[model samples]
Target: MIKRLINLPEKSSFFLFGARQTGKSTLVRENLKNGWYVDLLHSEEYHLYLKAPEQFRRNSVYKIEKEGVTEIVIDEIQRVPALLNEIHSLIADYPGTRFIMTGSSARKLCRGGVNLLGGRAVERRLHPLTYLEQKENFNLETALRFGTLVGCAGKSEIETQETLAAYADTYLREEIQSEGIARNLAGFSRFLDIAAARNGEIVNQTGIGRECGLSCNSVKSYYSILEDTLIGIRIDPYIKSVGKRVSAHPKYYLFDTGIANALQKQLTAGLDPVRRGRLFEQFIVLETYRMISYRRSEAELFYWRTRSGSEVDLLIVKHGTIQAAIEIKSGTSVAQPDCRGLRDFGQNNPDVPLFLVGAIGQPFFLGNVQVLPWERYLENLEQWL
Candidate 1:
């Protein structure tokens, strides 16, 4: 398996969040050498923590102070979120110990539950392997088709597809039911399949409701559950006073294309690279989003579009100012249409960085935007740090 970057925080209290089987436990275990693990999924541990949160904290503290105990790994921490408040107090009392907390779901965590970091603990999201992770041996051409989860380029297309499908059934399906995201497995599963097939499109709740045989409100609520559960997300259009013509509909995207393909019933492939360019861009958008949040950067991801034809795929606004305008493309053809909207945005709003992220090799300056591949852009993430 590919390893997480070596630079993430190991000494501080960490709450690792991700979809099930995305390697939350694996990453934490591999990095931790001295932590005592508390598997709350175990019935005894769950009852113990739920019954006496104080005692749970004592167990955690005892582990921390033991001769060999250097840290504490609370697996499935969300199972008993009440322990977070106790953990918070323990951190105050025992500042010497480190913590490596892992959870498969974030539904409660994001709402600022009691024991969570609440601005104190650093939050890290462990997503499935990215393009970079499996790039060493994977085939770039086929991997590009599904975007990269593990750079499984050397693996046959069938094997890679099966892995993704298994992840959907084993991790996503299990997590959803076990965590009570939806009581109806059949309807929810149908939603997943439909959303994946419709990935990379602007969808209103009403349309999805009609397709899924659910009410509009039900569709909206389901989408929220997905966003919170870390399965899929919808990015709203950047609304500004640009006045003349900007589309207001938000674009929806599956969290990972590999996951998207597994949920989809059919593959939509065209020989023309530009034909599927938008989907490629959407893949980059999701990666950029996860990478930003993984780094704990305080940025919100959105896209910009006009009522007519002017558009930009991704926009980053921070601290009340539009900091960066990003446009995504399939290849590196250094042309006007690819760079026009980004350059125009930068020209209209000076001081903001304009960027064009694509799959094409090499990097160059095109007007106000720096045109570069997804990998090249990631190398400079520290600059944001």
Candidate 2:
């Protein structure tokens, strides 16, 4: 197994939040081997707590304390948010005990007003596998086609596709329906497909709602559900300066490329050149974002676009300053023409570093712009940032 970069604080409680199948349980099990585990996903456990959350602690916490176990792990804590009150009490009663809560969804907790363990627990996220963690085993093509879900990464093509397909149809759809996040299940179902097709694109609530037969506000809420479940990421437009006419809308990218394709009902591995290129860009953008997040860097990612079509695919901002800009091209070769966007952005922000990441190219410099193959860029990402 690849070692994750997330380091839990030894003295404090924490929340490990991620989408389903990101290996939260596996990581907890591996790291906290002796911790007392209470999986709310089990029907009996969930019902038991739903009946009397206080009694759960009286029975389970007492046994754990008696056995001298100080670490308590509660998987899918959102299923029984009422238990948070008891957890908070336990923490106060037993000063040495630390609770680790794992959740796949935060909507219920936040909306239900559950105790977040304020100032007591740190929050961390577990994302899909990154190139850094996978090292030599990372395959760009495979990642674009099958995503980097650890459980599905090394499997056969058919198996991987089938798994992702099931994830989209069963897990994603059912979870939303069970959560009762949407008033109309059919409309939400249709919105899922439309949204997936438009993944990695600028948000257009009115247009999306028109296609999905939903209202604009409903479409916005649906997107919120995606964010709450950790299945989608929104990158706001970079408009810190008024020198350029920048678009105000934000771009949304599905958490995983494979899941995005699965939701669109596309199982074919190969695509036409233009379609393939877009997917490649999405794949790289997600990888870059994940790398920065997994390392807990002080970098914020954004996209820059103007009315006349000048665009930089990604802008890495650190400490409220534009540190670096990148343009993604899915071609094997890079020429001067492909550096137009980066060149335009660099005209105003001369001090910021610019790069062009292509399918395959040796690291080279074109004036102020640095060009590198996507693989080489990822390998030397630290230097770029």
Candidate 3:
């Protein structure tokens, strides 16, 4: 398993929520070393919760307290929602007792909210493998080529891509449909395909809903379902400077590039080099964003598009300051015209770093902003911050 860099506070209890296979369980077990674990995923106690919740509660409290263990991990806590309230009460009364609740969905958890905002459980999101974490396993070239969010690499790119594509389908089957989030399972499956196809692009939910014959509200709710399931990510528009002509819509990104490719059902460029490169660019920006978010860094990922025509692929803001502006070109050839967003953003915030993040020869001066290749883009992220 790839070692997750996002560290949990050793002194305080927090909720670690993420999609299955993102290594939440592995991270906690490996890091905590001594927490008493109740794997709700494999427990008969989970079925008991569905039937007789009180019995499940009785066993948990007795199991933890009787063992004299203060730290506890309840895996797949959403599976046993009623246990949350009692768990909260356990932490509150014991004070010394700490609990870590992990789950993939919030819908069932919300419905089972015996307590809201989890007064005691601090909720934090665990995203898919980031560029930084995967560096130790896959080389920088492989990661950049595949982008982020693929699983099981074989000896060859063909074999690796095949494995990842299969994983994507299995992920949808296991996480989305089987999780029982959307009542219309078939519709949600189609929606996944559409969302994956449109990943890294501005989403028009109302239009998508109309096209899919789902209500706008249903589409919005379904988007939340994806968020809860940890399949999709949305970057809100950066509207801090309203005087500039800015686009009003947010952009959507899938958590994994393999999933995005699987949804589109195409592994390689085959012959269309241009299309493959664009997809590669999208993958890089999204994974870079995930790396920042997973670390609990204070940055919002956004895209800037002017009213007339100019556009920037990524605009990262840190605590109200425009920290970085980036444009993505998949190939080596880049011109001054391509640096429009960086120049424009620099005109407003002169200190913020700017870059064309793709296969652009080297990191050099493009009017004060840096220009670097995609292979080295992630490494430069820390420097920007």
Better of 1 and 2 by lDDT: 2
Identify the runs in model 1 with alpha carbons over 4 angstroms from their true place: 1-3, 41-58, 65-68, 111-114, 117-120, 131-139, 145-159, 241-248, 266-276, 331-355, 361-375, 380-385
Order of candidate numbers by TM-score, starting with the best:
2, 3, 1
For model 3 the TM-score comes to 0.86
lDDT of 2 by residue, 1-385 (tens): 7897666677788888988888899999888845789999999988999899988689756766678887889999988889888888888888788899999998888777778876677788888888778877887777887788866966898899889999999888877788666667788889899988888888889999999888998998998888898999888888876443243567888998889889988767586677678888888888888777767788888998878899999998888888789999898888898999999999999999899988874788988889888888888776545
Candidate 2 local distance difference test against the native: 0.84
lDDT of each: 0.70, 0.84, 0.70
Q: Is candidate 2 or candidate 3 better by lDDT?
A: 2
**Candidate 3: where are CA atoms >4 Å away?**
110-118, 140-167, 173-175, 241-247, 268-272, 344-351, 383-385
TM-score of each: 0.81, 0.95, 0.86
Over the full model, what C-alpha lDDT does candidate 1 score relative to the true structure? 0.70
Name the regions of candidate 2 deviating beyond 4 angstroms: 241-247, 383-385
Worst 10 residues of 3 by lDDT: 146-155
